[model samples]
Target chain A: MNFIDFIQAITEYDFLQKALVTSVMVGIICGVIGCFIILRGMSLMGDAISHAVLPGVAISYLLGINFFIGAVATGLLTALGIGFVSQNSRIKNDTAIGILFTSAFALGIILISFLRSSSDLYHILFGNVLAVRPSDMWMTLVIGIIVLGAIYLFYKELLVTSFDPTMAAAYGLSTRLVHYLLMTMLTLVTVASLQTVGIILVVAMLITPAATAYLLTNRLSRMIFLSAGFGTLSSIIGLYFSFTYNLSSGASIVLVATALFALVFIFSPRHGLLRKWKSPKKELTT
Target chain B: MYAVEVEGLSVSYFETTALEQLSARFTMGQLVGIIGPNGAGKSTFIKAIMGLIPSEATTITLLGLSAKEARTRVAYVPQRSTIDWDFPIRVLDAVLIGCYPKLGLFKRPRKQHRQLAMSCLERVGMQDYANRQIGELSGGQQQRVFLARALAQEAELLLLDEPFVGVDAGSERVIIDLLRTLRDEGKTIVVVHHDLSKAADYFDTLLLLNRRMIAVGSPADVLHAKTIEGAYGNPLAFLQKVEVSS
Candidate 1:
């Protein structure tokens, strides 16, 4: 199918429209939340939480309930568990994340094996946005609103806490509370994106666009806007290519984001590789 | 009135005691310097007072209110190294964080807050660099931006931990001058300083600590040879050199 054909299909098919809207929403919230993740050096946590949601998804499938509730439950449990282990023991945060996520992922695999008749496992693992149901679409939309709304309402708290938690504490802000809040939001975003990008590729969606935006801008607000724009564009373009060439939707979207990241990596004016080579002297003069 | 009052304050980390039975009071409108040898719990003292760390204190008050209640009336300037200078934020926006306590939750900065932040930046002579990224500034300039942020907090009591370390002499001069100015404005200012040579010139009162409070008095009284030797563990050769130069 060509670009024209893709557009025509989107207008004709409800499933295509749902896929487009859901993927785009996932793209946006992931970008926004990913900014905080990267800024706080919690990219690994994002990956861990995304993977840990699998057990929840599996359990939700087994219970014949909405996967959103199950995924979120497991995701949040993993996040809190990671925080607990790291905070209480000598083991570091990354180590805790490594231990918990793998265990949860393994349990998820075991649970899914028991539900052999649910052939959508491959779709869940690799994403099949073309098969997104209306419920999933609405879930993504609701998650998008909550995530964005929370961010907008608490931008100041988030900014201060991320940049300097010590200062935030001095001013009577609970850094730990803000951290947990971000973690809850991360779990929500992860669950919402499962239908569009799948469990395996959701982390790439979370980190890449924000990191690309990081290389381009010097301000958090600008970085967030730029990241959301990049994520949304990647989703749209990736969907177009996926529909046109029979490619995996999640892989195509992740590849597009990676390509955008590479472009910014080489050509970003401030921290770019190409700029470093082009004008070392210009930097000294400036 | 006392700006800060602490009684029976003790802080320990695991097995080691950082501060032992410390009781002290800082009066209002004084520029006080906490001078201590290494491992004297200078930073720990500040952190404890700000409630940044766990400690045991029989009573701790700021501006006649409990530490928790008076947090809104207090401003803190943490060590420069504690902050991630590479954070993607502009100078002006960073200063705006000082206004967050007043804004409470769910409200963004308004026009007046921006004006206040800009004026605070101007006070620190960083108005020209308002739009500059934080990572782009020099150590002193960055420190000044932090100071501007504390100023924007509009607090009655200011607590600073080592605002002068790794700073250029010019920046040091600006900071000391600004602290003096703030002191003159009837705000109580406390600084954790490393350089003993500048302590006499910088602070109205000097606190000498070595895991315990050695002395707290006017610089003339606290700079005594015996007191200095007691806190610093056998007056080093530099003490003589400094004494000779003076």
Candidate 2:
């Protein structure tokens, strides 16, 4: 289908409109939160939390409850568990994340296998944005508002904590509290993106656009703005491609983000590789 | 009022004790230096006092208040190496972080706060570098930026850990002069220093520490050869340098 055909479909179908709006919101929020995650060097934690929520989603499905409740619960539990193990023992944080997320993901797979109604299981692993329910769209909207509001109200705390924990602590800001709050926000964003990008690829949405913006700017505020723009653009274009080509919506979105990252990686004026390669001596001097 | 007061303070890692049963007092309007050799728990002592690390202390007071209660009233400049310079923050913004404690939660820095931060940067001679990314500055410039940040706090007590290490000579002079001026203004200043040769010249009171307080008194009293030898556990060449300088 052409651009006109896609626009026509968006206008004609209610589910199409919901999918568009939900994906765009997910894109924007993920981009904003991803800036902090990448800046804190917590990209791996983002991936881990996204995957760990799978068990919660599966359990929620089995219990016939809202997936949002269960997903957030398990996501927070895994985040706290990782923090506890890493802090209380000799094991490093990355190792703890690796061990816990895989276990949680495996448990989710096992639990999902037992349920006779397996049609939704595939959609859980790989998102089906076309099938986004009205409730799921509203849930995404709420999560977006809360996440964005929390960030706005607590930007200073988050900035100081992310930049220098010792300074934050010295000034009576609780770095641990800020960390747990970010983790909670991350889990919420992950759950919101579940129907849009799926559990397996939500982290990409959380990391790629932010990283792309990171390469282009040296200011946190600008980086966040740019990342959100990139994410939104990617979602709109990815949705268009998915509709036209009959492709996986989640994969298409992630690929569009990746493509943007690649472009920025090669062509960003200040930090791009092409600039360095073109003038190696000048780059070294600077 | 005393600037700092501690009794029976002990700090330890999992299996190793960093400092033990340390007791000391610092008066307001005095410049104090914590002098020790490597592994002498100097940084740990600062962290414990700042409530950045866990410790056991029978009594720890700052500016006549409990350590935790007085945190907002104290400004700290940690070791230069402790921060990630590569963070995406401008020099001015980094200094503006000092205004955060006073701004409280959910409140952004107003024009007055920004002006205060800028004036602090001007005091440290970093006004021109305000727009530069933190990583783009020299080590001395970065140190000055941190000092500017500490200055922006506008606190009664200032705690600095090894502010002179890796610093250029000019920056060192600028920092020491700034610190002395702050001290003269009735602010209590505490610095963790390792350079014994400069100890006598820099501090009004010297604290020689080696897992414990070996001496805490005037520089002339604490820089004695025996006191230096005891704290370092050896006759460091700096001991001879310090003796000759004294």
Candidate 3:
């Protein structure tokens, strides 16, 4: 379809509208939290939490409750488990993350095998943005507000804690509490993103846009805003590609985001590889 | 009242003792230096007193208040290496972190707080660099930013860990002068120092430590050959000879 045809389809179809709104909301929230995730060097942790929520999703399907509630509960448990194991043992944090996420993902696979409605399971693994219901859109909206509001309210605490936990603690802020709060926020963002990109691709949403912005900006606030803008732009563009080419929505979305990141990686004026290669004389002059 | 006091404080890592049972007190308005050989628990000692690390102590107080209660009134500058200098924050924003404890949760830094942070940067001679990204600054400038953050805390007591390691000479001189000024303003300053040569001139009181309190007194009294030998072992016999000669 041409651009005019796509715009007509968006207005004519309710499912497309819902998908677009849901994808954009997911992008904005993920971009905002992804800044903290990348800055704290917790990109892998974001991946781990996203994957570890699978068992909770399957279990919630069995119990006839909202998958989001189950996913968040299990996400928090996974975070606490990783924290506990890493803190108590000689094994490092990355090792602990590796062990816990794999075990949880395996458990999810086992549970999913027993479910009668396996079609929903497939959608959970590879997102079906076109299948997003109006209720799911509302859930995503509410969660997006909560995550954004929490970040706004505790910006300074999170900043100090992430930047220098030693100083944060010395100033009487509870570093452990701040850490767990961040974990909880990550869980919320992951669960909210489940329908947009599914578990497998959610981590891309959490890291790519933020990292792209990181390469372009020198300030965290600006990085967050730029990441959100990139995320929203990628989602809108990805939706167009999916609609026109009859492609999988989540994959297209992630691919566009990744492509944007690659573009920025090669061409960002301040930190780009190309710029650095071309500006050898600038360094000498400075 | 003493600026800091501790009784029978001890810290241990897994399968290794970091600091043995130790007792010491530091009076207000004094510039104290904690000097020890590598792995002598100099950093560990300050961390424990600040409650950054878990430890057992019979009694610990700051200005007659419990350590936990007085923590907000204290400022600490960790080693430069411990911070992620590449973080995407301007120097001004970093300095404003010192006011976080006061603002607590839910409140943003107001105009007054910004002015206070800028003033602290001015005091550190970094006001011109406030808008610059932290990673763009030199090592000494980064140290000055940390100092500016500590000053913005407006604390009565300051604890610094290895403030001079890998720093340029100009930064070193600036830091020492700043500490002396803070001291004259009646704030207690404790520095974890390694350079024995400068220790005599830098600190009014010397705390010679080696997993335990070896000595604590005025520089003239504690810089003795016997105390130096006790804290640093025979590897520094040259220091003892130098002390006797001087």
Candidate maximizing DockQ: 1
Q: Which candidate, 2 or 3, has the higher lDDT?
A: 2
lDDT of 3: 0.89
Instruction: Give me candidate 3's TM-score against the actual structure.
Output: 0.96
Show the colliding residue pairs in model 3.
none
* Candidate 1 vs 3: which has more lDDT: 1
Model 3 bad stretches (over 4 Å): A280-286, B235-246
Per-residue CA lDDT of model 2 for B166-196, tens digit only, reads: 8888999999999999998899999999888
Model 1 residue B2 CA deviation in Å = 1.2
lDDT of 1: 0.90
lDDT of 1 at B26: 89
**lDDT of all predictions, in order shown?**
0.90, 0.91, 0.89
**Residue B237, candidate 2: C-alpha displacement in angstroms:** 3.2
> Which of candidates 1 and 2 is the stronger one according to DockQ?
1
In order, what DockQ does each candidate have? 0.61, 0.58, 0.59
- Candidate 3 lDDT for residue B46: 92
lDDT of 1 by residue, A1-286 (tens): 6788889999999988998999999999999999999999999999999888888988988899987889889998998899899988889989999999999998988888887545667777789999898888988999999999999998988899999999899989999999989999999999888888888899999999999999999999999999999999899999999888989999999999999999999999898999888877333111
lDDT of 3 at A212: 99
